[model samples]
Target: MIDAEITFRKLEIFLCYMQEETISRAANQLGISSVSVHRALHSLEEGMRCPLFTHKGRNLVPLPQAHRLAEHATEVLSKMHQGIDETRQIAGIGQGRVRIGTLYSLTLDTVPKLLMGLKLRRSELEVDLTMGSNSDLLHQLEHQKLHAILISVTDSDVDQHQYEVLPLFEDDIFLAAPKLSTLSDRHSVDLRSLKNEHFVSLNEGFATYHGFQEAFKIAGFAPKIVTRVNDIFSMVNLVQAGVGYTLLPGRLIHAYRDSIRILSLSSDYQMRQTIALVYAHNQQLDPNLLALVAEGRMYARRRSEKR
Candidate 1:
């Protein structure tokens, strides 16, 4: 008993109502008469056999059911757009390439592994990968320069309405020091013990930089920052040379463990980084990007299962 007559027009009206929050406002935005807007909603309600809104004096407030419907409506519309784009591509009128963005820290392994996974499946797929800071990547995504991004959820403030997010992994920050250091001999490094320690950190806009700032805040003292570098690998190089200790994610430490010792923080000082794959929710997903997403999901699952 599904509603076969639920037209795209009706769904568009529904989404417009969700955005504008009123019949008149929705109507105004759609450039349609108030009566037509009302009729469309009424028809949709009849088709679904459910009320999407509740009247409150002069205002029409969306019910919880309406919010739920909005999610479906968005997916339906997005899929419809994808269908059209795919149709055009199949007709030999459109290009097929996926532009992916990532933060600098992922360059060491995650991005390369993902690209390898993507290329292994489809050698014909064209993949364009760009690396930047977290905010820079998000900005590129917003400007349509990139179709997808991988970033730390703890450091990103992405708008959920505009993007689909897939959480990847839980990474904890570790204090990275020289391999033969006294701090490495500790069972757990106390943050207060390093009040006067020199620190090497990534410049602002990096997720690790924010994590570094958070660790200091928890320690209740400003770290004696010796130098702010642009990338985590460079900071690792600095730490290995005994220039200073730096905070880094477990992944980075795991990669360079032979050269550095990553110490765990004591109680009330541990913070975690949640990495995620984000892409535009409203666009037609490119086939290659779709493959990358699938691989990323599988990678996340395996990583989670191992832990």
Candidate 2:
């Protein structure tokens, strides 16, 4: 029977040392100290009850037995990883396909760029996209209906203990109106000044809607609501058709620059949205989610560089 002291971690260190041919190099690869590597190898040999290495002029060289153990160790580690992947799949934790949820507003650029990056990183990954309001997305994520979600963290109650969050970017909210509207020439709009104006808004669950509520609450009075929509694109259309003014994040500015007017909110009513990628804390180790997180970080870096 194998010794109980023999461990997968010891095998990993042994294999690294075998390939690198030096304790220091192996330690560097494993992110451990050289002493730790030496101790682990010595312990491994003791567990095996054989001489796996021979000292030669300040260097420890692998013997023939070590070479044979290396082959078996490599196979063992490979099989162990395969078993983990298979188990995760059977448990429905690490499926080949990833279900991603996002806010409707993000589909304009942020979501597309990240998805493209993810596809490039994982060619065999099957992706399913769902778009909804912030509250809706978070609800789906909490219930495990979505593998991950991209949504605004600001004003949305995300429990940090339950989710792993990666912030992508910060976007300022702006007052949106028709291009030829009377308010178009203004550098910025005060929510207090529009207390009597008719406005279109997203329904209660959206992050933008939360901002809308806060901005108006700060203004101390509610504006007349002309209509309520579920998505930002529809609200943008209503604003362009001169239906009513609405608040939107800065991300959509360039897309509607020609048709809609986007003005900065006054200091008193200014709101910023923090968009992030969020997944279950337990799913952080899932390979597909790992790729998604990496892509999100890359996207965030590129976005910051452009600023």
Candidate 3:
């Protein structure tokens, strides 16, 4: 039976002693005291039930048996280190699946590029994605249904305790109107300018709607909201129909440029929303999660620099 106390360190010292052929030299190479190296060599020899080395005056020379064991020891240590590296890679902290939730606005460009970059760097990893409203996605994140979530920040209810948030980018809100509307010819228009016109808006829980309300208040008029829709696509569709005008992210205008005309906001009260990626505070230490957060921060910085 093998003695449990015969450790890998002993084997390493044994191999070092064989290579250096001197306890003092081997200890120097290993950054260990000579006494400790000598103890390890003797312990390994005892465990193997054989004398592994012969003393040549002050120098130690390896026996035939010791040379054979040293060869095998090198292979064994190499395999052991390889196993450790592969295991770490499989733990998702190095190379494993990351489930992410994002808002629809981000799905336009930045999120896809980030995912593509992650995939290129770690080909073995799998990414699962979900898109929804900030509130819905945050709820899923709280329930541990997702590894991380990217969402637009809002004035609505938020739970500060459960998540670790990193603010990424801010998108200005633009006024999207029908292609032939009078508002389309203007370079910029305040919310008050659209007070008499019909307005399309997102439903109650959306961050865009809240931003619109704030913009309206700043313009000194409560908007005459004629329609409330669920998603940006529907809101944009309503604006395209000549039914009304709506506030949307600048990114969204670029995405659906063919469908509607985007106009800049005139007042100093420009509406904007901050986007961020959030994860559980406890999971921050997870190697895979930490790597993803680092990648996200890098991606955000790069995109911000381009702006």
lDDT of 3 by residue, 185-290 (tens): 5467767767798899888757787888888878888878888977778788888888888888887867778878888888666867888888887678876677
Assess every candidate by TM-score.
Answer: 0.69, 0.78, 0.67
For model 3, what is the error of residue 92's alpha carbon versus the real structure, in angstroms, after optimal superposition? Answer: 9.5
Q: Residue 261 lDDT in model 2?
A: 87
Judge candidate 2 at residue 156 and give its lDDT.
35
Q: Which is better, 2 or 3, measured by lDDT?
A: 2
Q: lDDT by residue for model 2 over 96-119, one digit each (tens)?
A: 799999999999999889889998
By TM-score: ranked, best first = 2, 1, 3
- Candidate with top lDDT is 2
Q: Model 3 segments beyond 4 Å from truth? A: 1-95, 154-161, 184-186
Model 1 stretches astray by more than 4 angstroms: 1-94
On TM-score, the stronger of 1 and 3 is 1
